[model samples]
Target: MKKLSVSILGTGFVGLCSAVCFAHRGIKVIASTHNEEKANLINQGIAPFYEVELEEILKEVVNRNDGNFKCLVGRKQAILDTDISMIIVGTPMGEDKRIDLTLMEKAAKEIGEVLRMKENYHLTVVRSTVIPGTTRNLVGDTIQKISGKELGKDFGLCMQPEFLAEGRSIKDTFYPDRIVIGEFDKKSGDILQELYESFYGDHLKKAPILRINLESAELVKYGNNCLLATKISYANEFANLAELVPGVDVVQVMKGVGLDYRICERFLGAGVGFGGSCFPKDINAIKAFAQSKGYDPRLLNAVLAINDDQAIHIVDLAENTLNNLSNKKIALLGLAFKPGTDDMRQAPSIRIINELKRRNASNIIGYDPKAKESAREVLGNKIQYANNIEELLKDADCAIITTEWDEFKILKPSKFIRLMKNPFVIDGRRIFSFEEFDKELTFRAIGRVALK
Candidate 1:
């Protein structure tokens, strides 16, 4: 059987991951991006952003797959050259908190223009997450209007949302828990199913495939993220209650709660709350979406509220410990939202740092294994950047562990004692144990009693 030729119409995290994953499965992948610099870097096998194993896989596909994968700057050429085009562009939040589908609409129009000149049948898939009816009503209508092509006759459309976390996107893409295909017609659905089967046949036996309507497919993506966000918020709520009760450990309590089969221990760990690209934006988008349809999303609104409060609580913990933060040299141990990637979108660290500045902290130093450069873009000269963990801790009055990176987890307690003027640590992710630190060191973690 001839392999399918695919074009990914964006070079963000999702588009890059999809391109590499498809190319690894022997499909020819053309990754399209409007940024020439990004395209040049990708062509050289370097990913623009940090994702685990993305660079290595991209190198394998670009250099060793006999030209199976290539990154280009224009969407029209890539669309014309491929049998399938997947729209993975950004859907940033608009002013009204709705998903701004400007990039998605542009990509669809470009694909539509390309399809007008071609005689061969092509499949257009929406891999970006949008509101429920977006795939059919917005993307499909735009493409059809621009190309003069009739849906289910001249071309086919499908909604297949990606369920990838930022840090582990490559693993998630190659081994998704489920594959969803929302088809406009049977022919389009069958073709997409076959393509997925060719790539994920072995995994399908373990992970089920869902064939549903376009709206359901779109809803599935938002539903999954919102539920996970809800779990994190729920745990944080418990953590807040646990603080009032001395000697109560939220971790052990949640562990017992998760032993129940109904609530497994996935996103149950309480920390500085959920922050990243997906949770904050998706929850807001969904809430706005519901309101637009004359519906109220109370639970989702509470989830956002809990998350916002959690970020503020971390700053409260720091201020209470130091007594006065006006001239304190504070050390922030992590910058990225979570470990393993350089993505700092809505990271708890950002809120924590901003609050520290507002409280007149004299010096705020930050360190991240991979996200320092990315953090610089968001934080700029507002805070000090550290070369290493030791440097971040040097002469610091207190330290806060925001991200639970492996490097931060393995640090010896003596390092804190030796470097900091006062070894006061506020652990957001609970990466350390109370008993591990020396008597001179002060340690506090969320959902547990502080140790002095």
Candidate 2:
């Protein structure tokens, strides 16, 4: 059996992680970027972005001196060297709420350019999230124009959607729940599947795979994310209703609902809303795609609308609780969209902080274990940043636990009582124990109303 060599385009979460992890698994990975600086950083085993457990593996992979993985600026050379080339570039959303394939188009052009020079039938995998028909029509046609070769005979195409969470990407990559390979043909699927077989040898037994056609794979990514977003919005809607009645906890309601065997409790937690890289972007893209195809997706529209209001709902809880935000020292417990990663792309904290500023909150400060620096990019000097959880709560009038980071989860009620000028707590993630927190001070939370 010949060894598997893979080349990846782009150096985002998927591209970089896939390169390092595949190399860590002893597969040769030639990762390339248009940016010389980014390529340099990867070659030096430094990750330009923050992801948990990436640097360790990357460093190990680089230090092996095995040339298993190394980033290059020459993407064409990178493709020439590898048997399978995966396009993992960004497909950003435009102001029109549609998928912008500028990066993908560039990658496809590069792939076609490479194929024109190459002899062997290469496998081109689209790992980036794209709309249906993008692989065959946009990417394939472009490749054919440049290379002057037929699809199945000259080179193969596969749409392999990546399901990686920002924080837990390495673990997710190593222990994927499932594998999906959307193939242009059976040969494409077979080649990609064989590569996975080599990559995950024994672990491949644990992971199930879906070998489907191109559009299904693309839509599967959107469907998976949109449904999760809907679940979050659904829980938020229930949370809103729960807030109307005295002492009604939507946490309890969700627990009951989740017990119905069909709906297992996963993304059902009612929080400020869903954010970060994927959920918000995918929903908007797919919704826009559906609209362009002459079908209005009203449910997704509602999902986004509900998500937008959630941050405001949290701020509303704070304002109503304190009576006036004119002079309250607001402390935000978490700044990142979620725990572990320092990505604040569409974090709810941004919306929450903006709302706090609008209401004339005296002094707003925030603390997150990892996201402080990343938060600064979006938040700038809008809010003072606390070095630790204690400093965040110290002399604060009230604090809201926005993202459920593990650090905030351990803080006892006594800590809040001792640190704050007046201990008013809003558990945005329902992480605090109502039994314990209520016994100490005025406690409010999302999904449940405070008892009078």
Candidate 3:
């Protein structure tokens, strides 16, 4: 069997992951990017961002196969050279809170221009998280206008949304729960299905392949994220209620709630609300998109409202515990939105730190194993960056664990007791056991009663 060739546009998380995963499966992959530096680095077997096991797989694929994996500076040649082209460009949030499709449109225009020069049939898939009607209207119209090609006749178009999380992208790509292909026509859908089967069919025995319309495919991405975001917010709400009632533990309550067959325990863990690349943006975009279509997304709006308030609530816990935040040396244990990845976009730590600053905290020190560099980009000297956890907690009045990194979980309670002047700990992620701490130490956690 002749191996399928694929071109991935935009060398960000999704694109690069897809390229390497496909190449690992013995398919020829052309990773297309506008950034020459990024392309050069990938070509040399270097990954631009930190993803678990991504660099090793990328290096293995690049070295094992002679020309199976390649990174190029532009999309034109890559489009002409490959059998399939996947658009994975960044769709940043606009000022109005809707998804800004500027990068997606630019990639579409470029793909259309390149398609004009090629004669063979090719499949163009939108793998980015876009609003519904975009694949059929904006992307299809732009490509058809420039290439003079008709969808389902001269070429193929499909919406294959990616579901890989930031930290576990490689694992998710290699073993996805399912594969969704939303096509303009039967032929396009069939082609994409065959390609995916070639790579993942044997590995994912039980994972279903869903074939649906373009609009449904686009909406599925938003639907999946919104539901997860709702779950997190719901858990937080329950935690708040549990805190008021005596002898109630949110973790134990949630554990029993999750044991029910209907609701499995996945995103049920309560913490400072979710904040990464997807959940917050997708919820806001869908809300804005729904409003534009003359429908009010009340549930989604409430979810956003709850999340925004949750971040502030963490700061309030710290302030109330200390009685005054002014000139207090506080320590933030985690900076990333979650564990495993360095991405800090919309991280709850950002809001919590900013709130502490507003309350006149004298010195806010932060430390994260992987996110320090990325956090520095957003924080920019506003707070002190600690070389290690000890440095962050030393001489601090209060300590908050924002992200649940493994290193933070193994810390001895004695460290916090001996290092801090006041020895107060606020556990945002419920990382420590309340009973483990000594009576002299002050301990507080979200969804649990404060212990002294």
Candidate 4:
């Protein structure tokens, strides 16, 4: 049997991870990018974004391929010559809350032009988060119109949505709960399934591959993200309730809720709502899609509203605690949204800093191991960037942990408490306990009892 050729467009998070995952399973990957600089980064075994295991995986694939199936910049001859091309380009949200499919549209046109220059039957799979009917409308129809080829006869079409977390992208790709494929027909489904033949079988024996219509697959991506967003909002709502009630902690409430079989305890922590590439974008897309279909989407709108409030709750606490915040040096422990990756797209840190700046809060200092550069870009001139934890907390009036980077978890309280001018720490992520801190420092944690 001849090996199937695969090309992944867009060198961003989704594209890079997908390329390496396929290559790890022995598929020939032509990871395509428009810029020569990004392509050079990939060729040199460096991932464009900060993912935990992506560098290792990318380097392994490139070394194994011996430069044959490596990252290629531009619409190179090799990418156009490949048998299968997957579109993982970004589809950003426009001002109107609709998905901006311009990137995907341009990539599809290029792929179609490549198809026009070829005779073999080619299959194009879209893995980006797009609105329903995008593959059929934006990609499939565009390719058909451009290449002058009949759909499902001269060529094939499918949508395979990617489910990857920012930091845990590598593991999530290969070991996903299940792989869903929306194909035009069973033949198209089978051919696409063959690409993942190596990864599936043993662990997911029963229903490793799920077959659905193209729109269903697109809907599945949105549905999953919306549900996750709901979980965060639900937890935050409970945390607000807990705050109002005396002696009730949302941490205990979540612990009780998680003990139930249905809840299972993920995204239940009530600190500053979710911020990253997936949750915000996906939830907004769901709202836009729902509104377009004539639905009110009130529930999703509330979810976002609650999240916005959640982001500011910490700053509110800080302001309420200190009467005047000007000229007071405040320390922020984490910057990335949930850590592990250097992506700070919608990080709650941005919200907290902006709010603080508005109220003329003291000097805001931030320190994060991985997300300093990205955070710096978002927080330019608004705050000072600290080199280390000690520097961040030096003579600080209060400390807040927005992102739960693991390194912050193990820091000795004795060390943190000693450096502060006034020992008031807001455990926004519920990272520390009373046992860690002395009686002098007042600890204010989310959904937990405060100790002075």
Candidate rank order under lDDT: 2, 1, 3, 4
Give candidate 4's error at residue 391 in angstroms: 0.7
Score every model by TM-score.
0.98, 0.97, 0.98, 0.96
Off by over 4 Å in 3: 438-440
lDDT of each: 0.89, 0.91, 0.89, 0.83
Global Cα lDDT for candidate 3 = 0.89
Candidate whose lDDT is highest? 2
**Least well predicted 10-residue stretch by lDDT in candidate 3:** 434-443
Of candidates 2 and 1, the better by lDDT: 2
lDDT of 4: 0.83
How well is each residue in 94-187 modelled by candidate 3, as lDDT tens digits?
8888999999999989989988988988899999999999999999889999999887888899999899998899999988999999999999
lDDT of 2 by residue, 91-117 (tens): 987888788999999999999998999
Residue pairs that clash (backbone atoms under 3 angstroms), model 2: none
Off-target runs (Cα >4 Å) in candidate 1 are 438-440
